[model samples]
Target: MTVMNADEIRKLLPHRWPFLLLDRVIELKPGVSGVGIKNVTISEPFFEGHFPTESIMPGVLIVEALAQMTAVVYCTGALQAMREAEQEVAATAEAQLEPAEEIDISSRVGYLVAIRDMKFMKPVVPGDQLLLKVKIGRSVGILSKVNVAAYVGKVCVVEGTLSVSQRP
Candidate 1:
């Protein structure tokens, strides 16, 4: 149950400031599911124009945040699988040597190919802590189907399924 901060998340994802939405990944299960957080603030650039009088976080950005969280889960799972494979090889050879360096997975970030049954029940505003959760429902080759949802406390803010295709 390793936790990933912004720095570690950046290593696995290519998104930068003003774009990268994940604030912290609280829990991750390799090749399965993950839970994360996004702290919304009034300072966000989108809030400026999204509504001059009444600010609300855009629904699209919320979906994008879920995608980023999916990247964390997906890439971390791959990295873990790689390391385990390396360990197996090392054991078989009985080599008195350290495992190789961690693979650079920065470019492994995938593209969001699809979103299905998306729903937004409430608006996200400043001072809200958006909780993001995602589960990999199915994976075939380099493509995956992810079930995603976001919440503010116990209230569901958004729910949907997204398809991701890993970068080769």
Candidate 2:
């Protein structure tokens, strides 16, 4: 299992501060599965608007955290996809998480294909550590399904299925 620090994550993803929801990847198994952690802090800028007096981590951000980890899983399969495409573009491409990594951000977009049965069992607040675990469900063509669950210790705070379709 390869553990990814913030710097390593920067090399593999295109998210930045405020938007980069995950802190580090604790466990990774390439194409199979992965676990990531997001440390929620009172200093996060979003708290200003999310709630002034009693700030709470937004559900959207929690989902994005899962998506980011899922992206890692998606990237692990990128090389294989390139081979199947009989394309050499990815060969010279260096991995980086900056938004600029994608050649056409406007034209080629990563679409949120679907989200099913999302259940928020508890709330995640500042000082809480969100443990996100993602498992590959199935992939067909350019779409991949991932099962995601976020927990704080033994309590499951959120769980859902996220589907992302790659524009080909």
Which candidate has the highest lDDT of all? Answer: 1
TM-score, each model?
0.93, 0.80
- lDDT of candidate 2 over 1-168, digit per residue (tens): 449888877767778886988788998876668999999999999999889888899998899999888877667556445454543443446444234243322233356789998898887899999999999888898888889999999899999999988767
Q: Going through the candidates in order, what is the number of backbone clashes in each? A: 0, 2
- Model 2: CA > 4 A from native: 80-110
Q: In model 2, where is the ten-residue run with the lowest total lDDT?
A: 100-109
Candidate 2 to truth, TM: 0.80
lDDT of each: 0.91, 0.80
The lDDT of model 2 is: 0.80
Residue pairs in collision within model 2? 13-97, 14-97
Clashes by residue pair, model 1: none
